[model samples]
Target: MSLLGDDSTESVAETVQETREVVQEEAPPKTGSTSFKLARLLFGGVLAFMAVDNFRNLEETVGYAESKGAPMAETTVPAITGSLLFGGLGIALWKLPRLAAGAVATFFVGITPVMHDFWTIDDEEQKQQQMIHFLKNLALLGGALAFLRVGEDD
Candidate 1:
């Protein structure tokens, strides 16, 4: 009765194929390469775990930050660590990836030098440790910057 092809097996199969093509066209591109995804997962998980560790040792963390001349160490440390917590989760889960990257980038930018001022340290052993921490933060920052390119509106 219809002008279009009948609801025969072939017609149904053709319709399915057309629908699949449309879906393929409309679907979002892949988020990241497999290697990058795995890296992101580990990076985010480590940041989150670090935040938890910081919180678990809040007093010691606050004291350390205070020793580094961090203003409002008690409040600032917790607030900054929160960015790590949520940002890490978002980065790992691919939720709000841009904002999450921003949060992570903020941490590395804001705290890396202040907390691990290797150049300012006189003690070789302490300076070496701090330098390692600083470089680690820089590497993590590089990863966060890469994640900023991820196609995500949230």
Candidate 2:
């Protein structure tokens, strides 16, 4: 059965051709966006900067992750931060957008709740600070999710 029409004998090639034509006809022309490009650059820059900062203080970051009860903190911290560095740069350069978005989204999802569990904090000030970090991660996750949609229209 062909998805392009009711014809049961339609070949895959024909269906693909028809679908391609339809998509080509329906897709809108792409628009240039200086603002979007700038945003990508900034978003990527921040991630890269944070990764570098964490690397510069690798022992401190590892210790902090250990304090948070993270297993294999010694190995995990550098890997995660390294991913952030590459993901950020990839996104900023638009070199590997889908991979970059995945990398970023993965980082946020993996670390945010673990690192910023405000519900687990008893001190009011610390809880507030963790909550702020949690919220910031949520926003960054949203941005990464948006980046995942970049090539969808194509």
Candidate 3:
């Protein structure tokens, strides 16, 4: 009976140790350059495209900004477009990513509330549309934060 008890305790300890080892072995490594590049493209591509689209339809974008009660729609629109273009390219190219992330994150923070103010909308369809855009921008903000933290030893 003593022999059986001793063997069982040892077996349990061994099993625990093996489990730990397996978990450690299976842990994912840090993101490699290839994976990081792909992530960068995914995160930055949308902003770049948006910037280009805004440039192409500058007048329409300015009008939308004006409808949202943005001051100086003409000047603000061009400035926003420039920031988006530069920030998106910087992020995608891994050039000053922290700053680029901050820019992109800032863009989302400033635009989401103003552009997608569901609380101020009367129509149900518009409210729903604004809510969706608001949520989507928040998710993008989270992604930008992650991108900012990437490469930090933390």
Candidate 4:
């Protein structure tokens, strides 16, 4: 009766069962320790704050993009997308710690250089400001990774 062949029905059932088992195996523990809870809260809070701050300054960010010769519309879209992605990852951190941390780390690596290109600036003060922002993001990325590592053992 199956379109594929006589073997298709059994293969489909096996795949479904395997998926269910994988899902069950990956489910988070019912009770998390205090340290794990604190880590999640801190990591999520930082991400949420950064997302909001970036979104609030979208106009300035777009202007910076324009200075770099990027189209305003294209630059604005990524800014908005990053804001939403960060905010969502912040929420996900509490529920899926490891995945959230990895996502945030990847995002930080992608955006840091673009956001703070100190090499492109000649003024010392502006260079320092860019370096500071770059370092801050690195610190946050480290924190997220640490939190995820600790959460994994819980």
The backbone clash count of each candidate, in order, is 1, 0, 0, 0
| Rank by lDDT (best first) | 1, 2, 3, 4
lDDT of each: 0.88, 0.87, 0.83, 0.68
Candidate 4 lDDT, 1-154, residue by residue in tens:
8798879988998999999999888956543667656656666776766676666776776677667655464665466447536634653456565566666777677667777788898999999999998899889777766755755755
Model 2 TM: 0.80
Q: Model 1 clash pairs?
A: 96-154
Q: Model 3: per-residue lDDT, tens digit, 1-154?
A: 5666988989999999999999888734355558878988977888888899999999999999899998898998888788887778877887887788878888888888988899999999999999999999899889888877762421
Q: Please, what is the TM-score per model?
A: 0.77, 0.80, 0.76, 0.61
lDDT of 1 by residue, 29-59 (tens): 4566697678778989999999999999999
Regarding TM-score, does 2 or 3 come out ahead?
A: 2
Once model 4 is optimally superposed onto the true structure by TM-score, how far is the C-alpha of residue 143 displaced, in angstroms?
1.8
* Shift of residue 112 alpha carbon in model 1, Å: 0.4
Off by over 4 Å in 4: 1-31, 68-93, 150-154
Candidate 3 lDDT at 36 equals 74
